[model samples]
Target: MDADTLRAILDAQAMQQQKAFDAQAMQRQMRHQKTLDAVMERMERMFSAMGATPAGAPASTAEFVTNSLSTRLPEFTYDPDSGCRFDVWYNRYEDIIANDGSTLDDAAKARLIVSKLDAATYARFTNHILPKKTFDVSLDETVKILKELFGHNTSVFARRYAYLRTQRNDETIRDYTGLVNRHREMAEFNDVTPEQMKCLVWICGLANPEDADIRVRDLRKMENNPQTTLKELSAEIQQFVDTRCQALRKPAIINTVWYVSQRRPHWAKDCDFANKTCHDCKRVGHKKGYCKNFTSKKKPIPKQKRRSANNVVTARPKLLPPLVSLKSANNTEINVRGHFNCNFNIDGHEGRGNCHEADTTSLLGLDWIAQDEPLFRRLTKGAICNVSASKLNTLRTSLTKQLQKQFVTVFAPGLGRCVKSKAHLALKPDAKPVFGKARPVPYAALPRISQEIDRLVAADVLSPIDHSDWAAPIVVVQKISPTLRRLLYWTERRTQATPAPTSNA
Candidate 1:
């Protein structure tokens, strides 16, 4: 009983009669799949009560390409820097349109899948299915929108962890059991690996260490054969892997001893590979990874001191912590290494501080991080950009109308008035007239600062003075604008801080 154990017992009785004809064809397809799932749930509730408009008014994919046959659908060139992977060129373009003996319809294969794609994926499929083109779509709605742009698929738990770590390395055993029977339905294996542990992970990937002597004589005769059948342990590991690849493709004759008088004969002069040593040049006659003066020694480069941008890289083993005496506001001696408490994380915001450690930095003071005004506006926030007047849209309207006609009164509107600076009311000996008081304004900014002080008091630049005894109190101060970050409704909130706040661009 030898032709590989009688062809693994006639392929385990033809996989037990194909598992009894697939359990009698799953009991005759469960009564025609429960009457085709109740006639597809009554044709999906009569097309959702007559809605997707499929009545007589529905025939346009250019009336199904009215006649085209002599086998065509081919043109599928790829190149997006062609290292091939768009789902392996869309499954070699659907296996060349299912072995193209063309019955071309679905609008000539949806205009040959958008005229064979690739000019940057047909410019992103004409910006995702155009004002309807490619003769207005079809081939199963353009291969479901080109499998939602470039068909990916992979997942079933990463193809069952790549078929439980597929192993046969230098390929053959019939292309490693034809890539484990084309991923055996991505290793679903009765869902969660139990057809005897998917034949013990395809017989532990043919026991790999370069087939450890075909795992001690052919996978220990099919791992104790509990009625063996990952196709008879892959035909008994392809019959001892074609008898160890035809005994490693033949020609091997090296039992060396031809020595006329070249010494070494007293039982090969103390054997043990003539006293083994050479762990890379310790010299003796080839042993630890055979090294006839093999190279790699390197280690000498250590120069580094040129530092200049106001040089300060002093960290060579200097951690003397608990010291205290400090004194700086013009009192000088503050080299304090003492003050402690610092826990503050920045983006993933945890807080606790009071720190100092200052032997030249690690201070942490910003008045206790500016007393957390929302973590000081999320650490001086500045990355949110649907234009906060990108400095007035990077202005170049003819260089902003040639700098607004060379700064007309400094680009004047209602305010910019400058007469080369001058101001003086330094009253002299016996000075007196002083009555300045009425100020309460901000009722939510009193009607927008009273319409910007009545447009600077109707642009005479202000002249409403009915009482002036050298008047002085005038404080409106409403300056900070860019609409407070555009009226503050900014929502994107992710700060659970494992140090993730990045924008240096």
Candidate 2:
């Protein structure tokens, strides 16, 4: 192209780029204004609720009002059915509004901020963000929101603790651990209450009085301070713990709780407390949620794991499937009830199936069915079996039966029929291969036998012979069964009936 033409093209491209950049800048500017507008709106609504103005109001009155409201809001939480919001109002001319020609008034901003908090976010902020250990609808609106989302239970917190156990590198656990320490300090020196102290100890697994002695000192220090009230101290400690806990890497630890709440079609009343017991109160009927005494000096138990120096060990978050009750589309109960091991039909045959069963160490031997020797030995010695996608159901069943049978025979005799020992029960030194199906018999004909051999090898009944990448041309498969013996015998006869190839000179 000519120099003049190239200059003109470059100029046009530059103009287009500048235009795009200007548009993005404008959009960003608009968004920033919107956020500021939302905050101002909240301030305004709060001011209005207090019957005062943000600016030009008596400085003393504004101070007194904001301080009082901050304290009262914790106790003056709005009922979900009340449709009441703790409003903060702002004067338009006094604050920075957007230049977007939209009337960025206080009401609009408040709505935007409130709207930004969707159901899930609101639930999280309510249940988890609050500082108190117990579930209280009467707490500060924000605190209530977090509690409502996370709920009062060890389940969510327990899973979080389990997740922290997986981080082998100390740094990951250290981040959260450090936050907890800070909260411990603040609660100790500020407004830590008996209830809050108990909850903190329980959640962090620092329940023992000896373990919590350090935290208890901080609480005593806070109580000695003449300035702080129970409300102020509670909020501070709550904020302190929540802030540190937020730094945790496993955000999804609580996400399962969120998912169960959203997708599972049941209210709080439907939850079953039968299987759980509170570590604090030691009550039989009530779980952690209804526990009145929050104070329990329990230190979190550290999980043990074998790891390399460079490896990061984190906790395994336990996943408990939500209780599912079937109901018709019309909201009628579907009467879905049965014992765990009711008759379940498998392959057109009635068989017993129990979803819940305990594992025994005896059946742990059968797990080596598909592992290399070293890996198998590692698992058996540790008595730890990694659940595989293929064998999970079978393994669960085998372990359950073995445990039940052993318990009955050893602990409670005459409870059930005892298993008779046989030669197969005695494990051999090379017992690993004995568990799996035997290798197939080999074929005589080269090309004809290759086809049959291909099937068995593909099915994993036969491993490669002498590390050859491809199947051997004239290999024979061993260990014939009656069913396969008949098919292979017929195949050999058919191949024999055909004449052999002869070379001509």
Candidate 3:
């Protein structure tokens, strides 16, 4: 009983101690697993709310991750008077934190919220809660303090209700409804259903009595029909308003030209001047009886005779050359010198004889003797007046060479005479000269203007002056070509003057 019993007892005690240790370790493992599961569930909920895939799924591609991270979060700076809503801020903050798919601790989130607070709010927190180490405060404690300090005030609800009571004429139906809804939320009034309250507010808020009555009738119809929603009613009301506005608009006028001749036969008699002609004066639009130049009386003058030696009459002025006539049945004959190859058909008739140049008088029925003298002389100038194509080509070549030598001086694209002429402004006896203010050149056109100025200077088209008695501002006009701008010297102010006396007094 001495050695064996003692050793057995020690071994049993040791085994019991080991079992207790194992049980404690197993309990700890279970607790750790529960904590891990809870965290995973929270993460899943946050990801779902943010429309992001769960962590267990494959990681998003690089582009997807980049787009998600690059999105800007809505910034909210706290206002003391309108104090930020805790729930709204928390939701936004949580989403922004989740954008990077990383977890943030409560302390870090609290610090971020404090950082966004306005100076007054931050001061209030520091003064009321933690003056020293304010950021060290927990998120839950900060949130609670903020809610108590800046949460909905009873006075705000009263003000909202007062605003709803007073309706404005210019306010739209949508805005009026929104205002009512906002107040209703703050007041937390549960006396009537939301839809009923909205309808009542809408009817009351309408400035026009007729519009209110119509809306009330529509609401009654909606009440009878359970499926119709308030949103649909609002849309219908907006549509009616738009249609009424269109109806109130003035209609466009259309002008049409009507033919009176087709409408009535009497129209021709009314517009008789159109076809009437004057017979006495040999003109249009009047009869012979109305001719102003016609005379009823006639007078005669005496004639003188020619006499001898010193008073002898000279020969009469030379008469014009007689027109030559040719007979043809099917074709017209044109004779230039001895050539008669220029015969052409005329009124389905043909000629049978060869005509000389002297035999043919009129050219295409135009009588050179009776026609303009200068034109006739030009038509009959040189002996070889009708030159061949080869001779004409030689003349053209010589003329082109001469033109090329003087092209720049003759064909400059500007006011050619204006360049040599100095502008003279006529002024009234008492009028004073006006010096115009110089306009600034635009930044985009500076380079182009500089280049144009340089070109003008080089061509001696423009020159700089040290001073002048009169100065006019330059106006730059843009052209179709981007490189070119038309610069004009505005002289309206300088040239315009008072009217002079119409007649010498």
Candidate 4:
């Protein structure tokens, strides 16, 4: 045979085989199609009888019931009008059944359900299904009957209202959010209700609206970002609540005024006082707030000596000076490091002020403050304080007082005179009396000199005569006392020097 004819023969056989296979497949498909149609029709009728749609088709959504499981639940103890969510309990019941480790048939399950029902429930179920037995119903139909009979059909509007009204109620934000979501589920709030909407709902239902500023601030935060998710909102709000709880638990400084008010009669109405007496006032009606003998006043700042150093120990200021670069008259920039409130004792005067920190030398510029402000007073005696006369005088005066106290007779007041012996002036024979003319005394010096002469004469230390051949000029010097400048009498007359010993005899 020719190659082309052989090929044609082979093609024809292959085509015939393919057609046969196609026909066989079509016959099998037709047979299976008939069976599927019958099964579907039967299922449709069964679903129709059961008042439900088949799982393959969309049916009216069944309402769910909720039950309070405040305690652990027992078997099949369902109450129809319990106003609780039934789907969750049903799932839990299914779990319980699944964990039973036994394959229970439809009749067995139905009978078990009927047997588990209370007497009242069993009677009610029998009456509801009168003229028919529970065992005769399919397992699915029995479950459906129990659902409709013992479960509450939650109203969409009512569930939504409850979701909207859900509040924190002192519950944690997580718990509050869960409660709201559960209600939203019952309300059939699908994903069409965005998370943003749920977040707004959560914010609106904050338990204590007037508790703090956090809620108002959080609302403002959400206003700026309308796309905030429930997770973000919950997380932020939870963090804020945690911070507030921590602050509340932290110890606070005792405010005396608040403390006193707490014990006040008007404030302490809740406290029992009939059998008690106040130790402060020793009166029954007396209140702690009105007591005048409280010793718990704020501690007074201790007095401290003034220091010349720029840095000092002080409290941190609540409001600090802004970091400003200061300029001197020469335009030298001075960067401020920090600022604080300080208590200062400058020149023996106490003052409180806000001080700035800088590396440059500190200056109490009169330009900064008003001159007439009369800050700290100046030194009373400003005669070169560098001498430290008062400090040395203190030591000398203390010692002098001690010596006078110890030897009262040896250290006499005014002037000291020797009663045991007298010194005789020994002069050379050629020594001559040199008298000097009296110099003119200024008006200021004249009063001081006359006062000194009168004091000396009163003490009998010097004798003043109306006429005197011997005379000398006196020098006037200012005294340290404030009363008057005492003058010192100085005579420059030459005197003979002769060594004379004290007569021990």
Best by lDDT: 4
Pitting candidate 1 against candidate 2, the one with the higher lDDT is 1
Clashing pairs in 3: 329-349, 329-350, 330-349, 330-350, 331-349, 331-350
Per-residue lDDT over 358-387 for candidate 2, one digit per residue giving the tens place of the 0 to 100 score: 221222222232224554455468674665
Q: Which ten residues in a row have the lowest lDDT in candidate 3?
A: 301-310
Per-residue lDDT of model 4, residues 50-70, tens digit only: 775354332222111012221
Which lDDT value does model 1 have at 245?
82
Please identify which of the two predictions, 2 or 3, would achieve the higher lDDT against the true structure: 3
Cα TM-score per model:
0.19, 0.15, 0.23, 0.23
Per-residue error (Å), model 3, residue 488: 36
Rank the candidate models, highest lDDT first.
4, 3, 1, 2
**RMSD of candidates 1 onward, in order:** 42.2, 41.2, 37.3, 52.8
Q: At residue 240, give the lDDT of candidate 2.
A: 62
lDDT of each: 0.59, 0.45, 0.59, 0.62
TM-score of 4: 0.23
* Per-residue lDDT of 8 in model 4: 100
Compare candidates 2 and 4 on TM-score and give the better one: 4
Model 4 scores what on Cα lDDT?
0.62
Task: Give lDDT tens digits, candidate 3, residues 294-325.
Answer: 56565533344323332455533333333444
List the candidate 3 regions with Cα displacement exceeding 4 Å: 1-75, 80-88, 91-102, 153-166, 190-505
Models sorted by TM-score, best on top: 3, 4, 1, 2
